[model samples]
Target: MTGLSGSGKSTAGRLLAQRLGRPLFDIDVLIEQHYGERIPTIFAHHGEEYFRDLESRILERTIQQTDSAIIVTGGGIVIRSENRQLMATHGVRIYMQVDPQISLERLRAQIASEEQQGKRPELRPMLAGPDPLANLLTMQATRESWYQEAEYLCVTNGRPVEHVVQEIIDMIEPTRNENEHAASLIGTPELSEPSTSDPVIPPIIRHVHIGDGYDTIVEWGGLSHIAEHLQRLSLPPRVFLITDSNIHDFYAPMLVARLRAAQFEPHVYTIPAGEASKSQRQLNAIYDWLVDQHAERREALIALGGGVVGDLVGFAAATYLRGVPLIQIPTSLLAQVDSAIGGKTGINHAKGKNLIGAFYHPRLVLADPLVLLSLQTRSRTEGWAEIVKYGIILDAELFALLEAHAEALREFSPASKALFCQIIARCIDLKVTIIEEDEREQGRRAILNYGHTAGHALENASGYGEWLHGEAVSLGMVVAARLAQKAGLYASEDVERQNNLLTALGLPTTYHGTVSAQDILSRMQLDKKVVGKRVHWIMPERIGQVRSMTLPDELVTQVVTEFFGAEEDHSHA
Candidate 1:
């Protein structure tokens, strides 16, 4: 249930849940309970981003915990695409649309009644403003589309709670029967999908549009719709798909089945899953496979796994026949948010990660958050390390969202796919902006290396694949933030906030690699981004902003020593 702040959604949802014999999850109350503070206090202290983050986290949790419940969301809940998508998928979304005057009147009457009973009413943030009705009108206009997307709309302007509850109950009963019948038919695939030759994928379905015919498509059941996305790109129907052995059995077959149905020929090559497979050896093998198939330059190369597969396949697409169309279907969170978006494709050297490659953009990038549900908890949580970097470097609101939803994002499952989708879309958008400004990392793009400088060094010093990239990055961010504070370019409290946020998300904020700090510092020199014999350091000035500059060798060496010397064994992270 959602609508204006005083639209009686809370009262209606509670009574409706009781009548229906289901649990009621109120997002506003949950926030108050979790933080030990009321809505207005939370908003005033943490700002709107923090409050919205909390709102999103609470909404996601409630959606996950209950299969059958009436959820009462705050007025501003519809402002977030993730929350709206989740609600649409999980429950019968109902918008309580009523006059602002009537809603305010009802709120005031309720408050007076509570005071007469010697009880204090919970103050709403929306109502705390000087001109609440104007705020309500503005919010309603902003979220009009979101409200209209709901399955049902309820108006309780002159009605009682019982009447509203009854109307909602009548609406839900028929849908329950239809949904149960549909669930039994879930795994049954359509023998044939209507083929479209329009060669134009709608912008709505395509999540991130990077202009010039390049788009990133992200959706839950998007694998089944690959033909539709590909049709618009107008590439040769005969495509080569490269994926890791671990993922071939799961997604490759499904994708192949769909492609073949659409009259396309798809030849899949499965490589071993790990950092080792992203090498010249695998590249040679792929070249051999493509040669045997007589693959042409216009045909597309589809990458269908994590970073390892993406890097290897992307390089093959870049160098093979001088350049072929490329499509990325990144299944892992790390790849979907970081590796897959940037056109930087490469293989690791004996000494470093991504030491060899090219700046080749994929014609299309398709990411399914549903696929992430198949990943282990550790694999899923590690992706947030790179995601946190986006928030710190370019977007403070994104950072706060991460801070608020750290736990849910860490333990993501089916219930959290929509939020993850939104998160992935956000990361992709940020990377796209940077890529457009400096596709070759000439200037602003270098800020993306915020945590990656020390992060890559850790990976190199610890031995490739010894420490996951995200773990190294988690510690790298902490070290970078500390360096910023020490240089007097950042606040100590800001450093603590970054550290705390990383820690809360189950990311390691301290180094525990066995390699000596001095060795790690030396490896930092070998970074592919080095120029003028100086390493570019991306340091934070606050939660959302950062500047790129090379720090003093002594300061860098001392910080490295401090981290590498720590006794804490969060390396297990």
Candidate 2:
């Protein structure tokens, strides 16, 4: 058991062990018994480093000695990565959670009561500060990520010790039985079969091994494998699933059932289904829900819808508790190809799209193509716009592939699963390579925003919900092609090919909205991509080649004016 001091880790572990008929090994008690001194005394005599090293050694010995024992560790045990790995590897790690304020209050009350009884308990070294509650909060913030590494999280605040123990037992019993059953089947014929179905082969998972942090996985029908993936990653069993109403209506029940089967406790939070949901109000509501659920850092915030849900929930996961584990289960084609793969999380400000956000990566991205089968035609076509952007900005082969199967893709027939998966994987591969080179979008990754400058501007000017992100991007790509043509940087035939392809895919090749060119220019100026008061335009030079240029305001205005068929205004110039 792991948690802040006075959060009942020791008490719960003891009771749980008693109920399970297993030996209970409390690390703190063992350490105190072995040293013949209190923890505070040890900390005072030997530095914290010394105590931690001794604690690690004792913990290792304890684990090696008893294979079936409930081990209660020091709250700071997870602070050491090796200690976390050991606990995760050896047993079912459970986190006893409580609000910092409540835990601190409990500790203070315990100390006062003990003193009144004429038996003063040893004061915790961490709680020695003038403001113990503040110290606890600070410590919790620092170690929250580590504590979140536990597989199970149980809230102990305002709950009886027995209730908390029962929660832990309920979480662990199924896993225990499964483990025993596996042990019994070690040499049986059933054990010889593969763990997953044949269609869900492991090799189908496209792993993005980028950097020291988490990698990404893109696979067909990957949603069914979410439980196994979570177990393998050792993510906490609790999930805060964030989805839009539409996606929740379709996918929530199935996903919840699957998660339950995997012994996961999932809580669903549904927002309205549209870009309108990606706002400050919805974000605050999500934060409130997280707090109400007593969400811990180790638990996951699973974004289970399109880009709107992904962006909203991803930003919430990034900021709430200073960040928690994120799992992106992108259902829309647009998200599977682009938005979900990148770590860009945000909400639209009044002036611009994705103005308030962070670059927090998800622990996992599960893009199941099967979900796209039920997608509306408009959503599917909107997604093609991004998929086409991938082809134009990075891979000519992908461009040609889409061109060859443009009609079939539009139909989105059941027989087109392989083609859809191929397209999704290729797009993800291109994105992963770019993200690996520039994780924070400081340089090379900007190419991925091929048409986003004008695209975002259009979305903002049209009041976000007027056009799907893909639709705006589709028109934005057309504007970009025209700009490239006017600059004489790209061949006219290539621009024509782009137009033809988009038209064939039933994507927008023009925008007839009321937003004036000036309004769009103003919105573009507020874009995150603007550098030195100039918008960075991604111009396609050819099928697979693109370049970024800081075009003059007048030139961009003229191009956008032509697209909107509006009179160009030169007041700013």
Candidate 3:
């Protein structure tokens, strides 16, 4: 059944397939393991535009080849008009709806429990810097409407797994009969009201084709995988390890050891920490470092550190020698969740963060949670903000896990170490599932940007250093929730609950006094989220759903006023 992300799309789809003895098809999972690298890495490498085109083409092909199977789509699949039309033509569409609160609680529980499982990696994209629940609330607002377009609606509120499965089974019986009749009546030009009462959903399917997912992971084995994948030429063996000072102390040695173990020669280069390192000066230094290392086109560049380092090194690798193979070894939580997985690499421009970057998909991404162990608490928590985002936008169970174990999560308590890994892995799995289906983000992948619209605006307006990315995002989520409330998508109580959770986590619901609403709005205009020069916001509806909307300029301003005035805190970010 299709619905919002945490509404149990994957679980229900699997259950129905099992009970009915039909093949279960999860487009996201199908592509998860195929890529050697992460989907976000590819986006960073190939650019969103290129990724979208690739995603659309792949989706078109996949749908055409599949038979009668149970399909679980990404939350934003309905946003692409073409995909929706295809679904209506090719298969039965059903929405498995759940209460937003339930969905949110489920997500938090999923992530928190996973951390206890030891199979989890790191909690990357599921939290807001210090606050996670607020981000979830914001995410719910951003994707609610897009999820309402399903053909069949099945409420999953307070229901057991078997009960939900049976309900879907019951719906399918009538839907199938309806489909058969519709086929026979397809050519009729005129129809009576009774005959037209139930319309047949289309089933035109599309398969998104992405290059081998395996090739995306260059750092995993130096050039071993690439050597086997594309065995055209063998050049002199050399390696460039590009990272920041902080990461150099953490992961560079591990990467260097791996390369050496693989019989490849490698060298390391280090930059300072934070956003400033991603500048022309740093890029030039990297070029010089490459020259000193005798790096060549055939050699691989290993990027180790957080997002800033990855962007800097990846861009250098993309432009150096016209293009060198780049691999990613992300150290920080943020890099692992958002930056490391996607191929969009670049440093911050004076005008905006990440304004100048290349879509240079990495050869591969090797994520080792061991590297994250070295992170300071603030840095660790910074990544949690993004982790909370994954649940808010789609996965309800993950949200629940965060809520259940917020205290342990905040401190990365020893008892919760395993939970951390599972949380990270789950988020990775969720993201990979979406990226595999819509690598270019022409359709399903945009759901991943659940809180980024306002988050980016805050970052740009306040200057890159003003607030941690996750911190701004935490506040952005609050503002988005307020906007959703104003739009009447959910009750004001939902917004208050969000603010309370954030306040408890030490994350602000409003911006610091230095940032003005107009400045943020102006910077928002420069956000890449703008379509046709119109800023599209991902607003919340309830606790577990969100949808996109293009707010009027005045409305946005009013919302901003409410956001800043929503609380009386005047602390710095």
Candidate 4:
């Protein structure tokens, strides 16, 4: 079982073990007992890398040693691919998918109770922040993509623990036997489906202008439909197409071709793939390219690619000629669902991921779901991670859809295509609504960062390239669940549900690498989300809902240590 620190994974796991008459092992407590010291001390003394290695080694041994015990995992255990593989090979993995709102409430209640019991800690990230809510929002946005990929996906919406547990039992019971053969059940194939040339545009639900009943699905009818959306924008100056090589090949020509067809002179600039491309060097290169192309402030820059391309291009657009009009044409799932809609764009810095950027909203966003059809399977799967985020933050119905039809939606089939379009459209609407209400991430927007507090730090510490944005998010979501559990907002069943969903979607639910608690917490401290040196975690109160909460630095550190205790040995500093 896995979830945020205060999310109650331990309680649920123990209950499940008791019900099944099996032994239960809480990975965090086990690690602490094995080390004969607190996890926070280990992090303070040895660092995250060392802790991560030890966690992986110990986890390997534990799984090998155990028979049919109900195992409770540290939140960070799913960060590494190896740990996920181990879970796949050994026992069933369950995640507690709770809401940030509930997590905050639960933690508050637990802390109050604990205080009554005279328990105390030295560091607390939440206690240090001035605007704890704002800091919490930042964490949610950063890690939003990770928590959405859990396998079982149960929403802990402040319900009784027994009810949540019953739901999980119904989903995972051996008698039902659905999950046992889940691997063999394929949804749709990559190439067997229709290509972009075979356009399937849906009616314009939001912008219904140029074409009478024009069809536009962000991924499939992407650039081809941009001209119509631009018409709504009153034909902003010359357009600059900024993208990476991967995206340039698939849709740049089509976008530029259509732009020229519409009597606009368009220029295309390409960058390499990976987070490394989002740097000062790349930014300077883009500056030179924009200058060479005579890009003016009037001409809008269209960001086309996954999150990396979107962030880099969006930042360039933000800085170039004092902020040019930006039009977002997000091609990736992550982009379409999260980054593309919010206007939060920026590049990575050596100090951290997305360390530098701007919150420049696009004049308009064009999401073509068909584009996902051509996306690599891993990339497409990564996108699903964000789709799951929509469910975690504000749409329980969407969560049910994902749980019910993940297989069907895996490949971009016609059914899957429509589902993707519907899902993206809904997410876009939700995001736009949040942005409109809290463009600066003041209140409701903070809920969007449901699982990102630790997600970003994990990305930064792992060296972004080591894990795909979605992969990091996948593991990060579990960490958030564990943290939530620690905060006491949920039960173990919620964590289990999240884990089942993630495993079903082929996402990680544990961290098994060599990153220690202190390093992760330090990197988190460096995050833009932290205010007044405080760490705010955006946890869920239920599926489709979230809440921002301020935690004490000591509690945050302890939670981090508990999550990373599994990796205490053989890890680097």
Candidate 5:
């Protein structure tokens, strides 16, 4: 099913999926679940390049893997040549048509209804501004020919969803020849049976979407089968695998060997590991390496490390000689759960972390939890800060789940794959929700920085190497909860619950670094989230809720001072 927004694709598709008793793979929902964000958020954060890339990837995967299912796609899915081709070759295609004006009206009604229910509905960014009807018409003009290419077209304006769905059902099963129709519905060509002499071919991949699209791919041994996956993608044969030294020793050689076995030209480059590697110097080195290898726009750069490598290589992919395709293979817990998804790429400055960057998303992200086994306890434990942030600011259930599994998770137990995967997927989902709301950190996205306002400052003041980003955030969340309490916005008991979770997760709940409150304050003023010379503080009203506001600098200082531990010698740090 395909159509402009408000054309009732979702409405009709739901009925069709039920009638057929098949799963519904609504592209919009799949994109949201896979990317862990919404269409508008993807647009606001990653831009058209990133969104289209994901859209195409998801469309292809949906078509390739499905035997029989209702696959509803966004109208703009036709914008790309690959998408048009993928749909053309597969499915009993149906285009749901509606008047642009009607579409616009339905959208407004949806927005109004969603708001009334306190739901965060997604809008097609292309057709969401003033003169939306004009935008819709313009989009229709661009996509009309493609929409017309579908095998069947059903007008949806003024018609009931059941009527439209039945009409589609009739088209799908013209003579009531149930067997033949079922065969077509399930995409069985049945042209001819190949003899045993025929060459063996790989079957369609089961692409498991975690968030945006690349979330669950790692659990399926996506790394072990990287070569096979690459063979199926449209990327160039020349691949660049970039990682930090700390990561290179663990997985780079194996990945390189596989790529070579598959006849791909893999150029491996290793940078010094740590946050410091996310710098202009390292970025320049990547550029030089790409040039030395005569990298072209068709070439893909694989970021095979944690957030530092993901951010640095992602930026290089975003701007090196214009742009190149990027594939994120995040090996760290933090990178997999937060950094790798949503395409927030950048480098840090001497003054602050991630002060320079772009919203260039990766073409694909492969997260293998098995790889996290390589992380030390400190590295593994810090990622919980971000995960816990999700529960604290948006999802109370996730927080409770973490509490239930706190001890096991802290131990990184290999026995809890299902639990771990669910936690990871849910965390990515919440992150996407925020990006959909405000990817630029102007409004809803600010909530994502619940602990980051002070966290980033503390990270900088203590020196980047002093504390892991997640540990700093864990402490920041604790302080913010306390701040809310002092400001009469929250109860002290809830603050303790939030704090106790972090402590149980093996995260830091207090600061004892050499950095002073004054130093932290000075750094806070320089945070990217600052608005009109005032830093925005995201304080919790309670678990699963947060509000953005500015607290008095004096009060902020007092809270930090209260939580401060005895000055510890950190020269080693």
Candidate 6:
């Protein structure tokens, strides 16, 4: 078991070992036992590097020697790549996840209780700082990528030790059984049979199973096979279809017919097509429609349109009788790539975009790239902005892919279907990984909003529909790139590459419309990401790398003004 200090790794391991009738081996204890010295004393005399080397050797030796044992390791063990490889290959590695704040409190409580016994304090060399909580958070962020490499991640905060242990066991046992079953079938005739389909072919269906949430399936022709996929899920017979007028006119009949063929009842409700539909008045209308249709908790809500429809319908699902099951059928490229996957659902407030919202994960997300063929050029190109954001933040390989296929993507050509499917799947995977790590916008997830801070401000400053959400974000990303360069946080060439990519995709790189810089800044102040009146600007350090920093108000204003045009008034209105 591995996790942050005071994350109950040792306790859980001991309990799990006892329950399993296995020996419990604590690596730290073994080191101290071997040297006849305390951990802190070892660290103080020999330094961290020496301790780490000794820890690695002992951990490898213990794993090699014991065929079946519960090995509780130090949190820092993951820092070494060799240790991680050994753990991954040799045994099931379980990560005990805990909130940094909770870990800090637990450590403090342990320290205080230990002091009462008149014993020497358990000195955590890493926790030696004026702000231990901050230190813990920093350390957690640094090691999170490595911790996620574990086979299973168990959230241990406020959970009973027995419960956490049981969860770990439950997660591991199924995998062990599956492995055994697969081993038993290895020599079976089924494996030797020649298949009609190509064995080397990549799967068209990209299935992302979010833990206890829902599965997200992205395929090229998924919309037509919606009923087939729905049959596999545990959805109710009745589906409340929430779509926009434009999407209804184009795709609703086929979907309704398919559902009917499957003997599932589908009730359709089409709001006017646009951002204007995602308002309180429209939301009330949806509630009225649901009530009129006698929608029940057991019934499912299907959001079938772009981000606007998905957000509106998702919010309705979340609120109407305290949420019903939601299935996202994202038609537009923007929805398929970004909004439809994450559980962020809400209507725009008069004050700002997504001002009213809820963290409601959907029952399923079905993204069909075939729908993009029907999208107008503007809508399709605008969606590319969000796709680019994913590249800028998390995946350099995706960024390169976009660059390589820039022309084909711009035309939305028939040949690009396979490439687009891969793009959508990659983007969805990146988002799912981040969402799994930080389900709420606690820390790491904020990177997903790389361009939204300025983008949302622009959308609010201008009328909501004046600039499409993706177009605004495209502009926002450019502004962020410029700000990063100005602040010397990002390289000039990287910014240029971003601009070139956006320009090549026919996405807006600058706000051409007339909007006051101060007004935009004022709207940005209302952003949810703002902490203590400071906006957390997500700056691109390089492709696939971004960092969030709270910039001074003046610096933000200057960046906004420079990007929107210097003639715009910066003074408060």
Name the weakest run of 10 consecutive residues (lDDT summed) in model 2.
185-194
Error of 1 at 565 (Å): 1.7
**TM-score, every prediction:** 0.64, 0.64, 0.58, 0.62, 0.62, 0.64
**Model 5 ranges off by over 4 Å:** 1-220, 565-573
Q: Tell me the tens digit of each residue's lDDT in model 3 across 1-573.
A: 456555667755655564454576676555444445444455556665654455555556677776656778754456567877777777667777765565555454445434423345333233424765555456556655655665567886534343466555555454444576222212222212231232332211122124544422212112223333222224345766667655443334334444454566666666778877889988888887678667768888878778888889889988998898877767777777677775678877777777787777766665545345446556777787777777677776887787777776775532344566667666766677777777766666776776677787777766677788878788788777777777778578767756665565556665665666767777887876788999877776765667777877887889886565433436673
Superposing all C-alpha atoms, what RMSD in Å does each candidate have to the true structure?
Answer: 21.2, 20.0, 24.3, 22.6, 22.6, 27.8
How many steric overlaps are in each model, in order? Answer: 0, 1, 99, 100, 9, 0
Show where candidate 2 strays beyond 4 Å. 1-203, 567-573
Better of 2 and 4 by TM-score: 2
lDDT of 2 by residue, 1-573 (tens): 899987877766765664455678999999999999989899989989999998999999998887667888887898888999888777777788888876765565456444533465888987887888888888899999888887788887645444465566556544544665222212121111121222343424556655446656666556766788888878878998888766654456456656777899877777778898889999998898899899998899999999999999999999999999999989899998899987899998888888899988888888877677556678878899998998899999999998999998987754566677778888888898898889898998999888888889988988886778888888889999989988888899999999899989988886666778778877888978878887888988899999888876677879987787664432210
Model 6 lDDT tens row, 1-573? 899987878767765665465688999999999989989899999999999999999998998787667889998999999999998887777899998876765565456434533457866876677888888888899999999998789998744454466566556554544664222212121111122221232334444555566778876657777888788886788998878766653456556657877888877777778998889989998898899888999799999999999999999999989988899999999999899988999998889889998989888898878677656678888899999999999999999999998987897754456688788888888898898888888989999998999899988877786788989998899889988888888999999889999999999775667687777888988998998888889998889899999876677778888778744434210
- The whole-model C-alpha lDDT of candidate 2 against the native structure comes to 0.79
lDDT for model 3, please: 0.63
- Residues 104-191 of candidate 1: C-alpha lDDT, one tens digit per residue: 6556544544453346776666677898777777778888888989878878664434445556655554454477522221223221
- Give the Å error, residue 3, model 3: 60
Clashes of 3: 99
| C-alpha RMSD between model 5 and the true structure | 22.6
Ranking by lDDT: 6, 2, 1, 5, 4, 3
Judging by lDDT against the true structure, name the best candidate: 6
Q: Against the unseen true structure, what C-alpha lDDT does each candidate score?
A: 0.77, 0.79, 0.63, 0.67, 0.76, 0.80
